[model samples]
Target: MIKNSTKVLVLCALALSLFNCSSDDDNDRGNWIERSVFDGVPRSNVVGFVIDELGYMGTGYDGDDYLVDFWQYNIAGDYWVQKADFPGTERSSATGFALDGLGYLGTGYDGVDELTDFWSYNPGSNSWTQKADFLGGVRQAAIGFGISGTGYIGTGYDGDNDRKDFYKYDPTSDTWSELVGFGGEKRRFGTTFTIGDKVYIGTGVSNGLYKTDFWEFDPSTEVFTSKLDLDEEDDYSITRSNAVGFTVDGLGYIVSGYNGGVLNSTWEYDPGTDEWEDITGLEGYSRQDALAFSTGTRAFVLLGRSGSLYLDDNYELFPQEDYDDED
Candidate 1:
């Protein structure tokens, strides 16, 4: 019953409405999505490493006690399965690194003492084997990374003091050799991750003050080069410790940690430009001592405390897009 021109105008109006909805969806595409919650006790200072497409997480301290249960998340299936218990003493503030298809964990604080024993996990057999003791002194809250077939560890609290001494482990020889010390101030509970062949380390508490100094370590030359500091005159830049750092699509990101108070701010670092840019933070409550790992195609943040309450919620970050809900 309508005229031809009237019908044309109605069609155009409908098309415009549909286009606007599509644009809104596109804007939220790269945001964080709630994923499967961790299938273990909620805890802080957890560690995670990726082997192929699967991520392994374990060994942290609940408010009541230290824990050693190990779990693996199948990224493709979006579920978690318990793995072999960590063979070391139940502890917290440990570090885990994946190397040559296996995972190595060591250097944590048991309830009674700081620990130096190290162990390696074999994913194929779901078993762990004792490795040479960490060359560094008994310590906790250290950082570890594997690169080009060798494992490196350094910079943690040795119970008596904060440490900067670095060490490298050659699995082929089952030996750890002390390397040059890290360039930054002696620190504990800092975050570390590798992009390409270089390892980046920064952001921690030392002498009652939180740090923002960032450094990149090249294994080939065994040198540490300073990167742009996280603290800036800009108010948006966040400097905190016990955060998680991971690399995705060749870019590195730091997310969620404590700086006097719990924090949820996120920052992206571009190695090409040696700069950092603040981005939308994660959704939900703020937290510290969380764990992050990349499954090549995606990066995940999971399980940390936010005061008296421990959290088991999990989130997947799309660093290329703005976060879904920013606080």
Candidate 2:
């Protein structure tokens, strides 16, 4: 029965348990870290999203009016909660995402009209549901991303033109279907993310220059592959358009804003190798139309407008890896 020296000691304990489980999966795939602060109350173009470690901001503009208010940030309790308010129409460069677990807001420019209207926030039912309107450019520095489960909006700038149409939004047939327009130039604000199902978009500003152009959408070959020209890190000054972008753990950040007012710095991109580094010994809150988001890996830069004031703050970025359990 079992006696070849106990089956060679049970095959040497299952080959040392599959070599220590791949040596802890190559020692946990390390190298990826960065952190920053300053996010107390600096409202600009805010509108956030991040379900899981929680991170949800709301409404924007405080230099005068425009701000329906709503907040909640507990990225491990760096704390900030004032949720509920922004149900629909109460604008500021609108656009937020998180389908499935619910959270959608759209278009922007309520400084009058440019709000293609779209709402759906149910942080477990705090309430708000209108959905399916932003088929593209309701206007206001637009640029959205949410792949796979679908929700791709595109380019913005509609006070005098500058938009490249590219809608998707298939909230289980809630509507919106235009895809394939954003080729660049008809711009507005910038930064988008998705990665696996392809979504990319990169630093922006159109007509007057300052665009690190970089497209990549591919909702199953809906096509949009450009890849690079992300202005090669010219250290963004103000090719302005209400900047805001997020993505951690896999790298990609673009904080603060105002090109005409002279950026506040905080750049860092690295789609594995697209590169755009600058973040080193940095700070925070020097914003512009803020409202960034990311899930567990962390990223949040809520509230904006730093030049003439108008903020409510909510910064929380987090990601610092250093693996090598003996690699």
| The best candidate in terms of lDDT | 1
How do the predictions measure up, each by TM-score? 0.88, 0.34
* TM-score of model 1 vs. true structure: 0.88
Please report how far candidate 2 places residue 88 from its true position, in Å.
Answer: 8.8
Can you tell me which runs of candidate 1 are displaced by over 4 Å?
1-30, 38-40, 325-327
Tens-place lDDT digits, model 2, residues 1-327: 569989999999999999999876643222323223344555577677777667777787766677777776777757667878986767887777876677787888878788888887888867777876786646877877666688777778777887777788888878888876567766778767665556677676787766756776777878787876756456533235567766776676666666666365666667768766654211344666767667737666655656776655444544354342321
Whole-model lDDT per candidate: 0.86, 0.68
Cand. 1 Cα-lDDT: 0.86
Off by over 4 Å in 2: 1-3, 26-56, 60-67, 72-77, 81-88, 91-141, 144-154, 157-162, 165-244, 247-268, 271-318, 322-327
What is candidate 2's local distance difference test score? 0.68
State how far residue 130 of model 1 sits from its true place (Å). Answer: 0.3
The residue-level lDDT of candidate 2 at 314 comes to 49
For 1-327, candidate 1 gives per-residue lDDT tens digits of 469889999999999999988776534324677889846568988777999899999999889989999999998899999999998899988988999999999999888899999999999999999999999979998889999999999998999998888899999999999998567988888888788989999988889888878899999999899887877547645678889998888988889998888988888788899877776677766899988978656999888989978888888888777544442
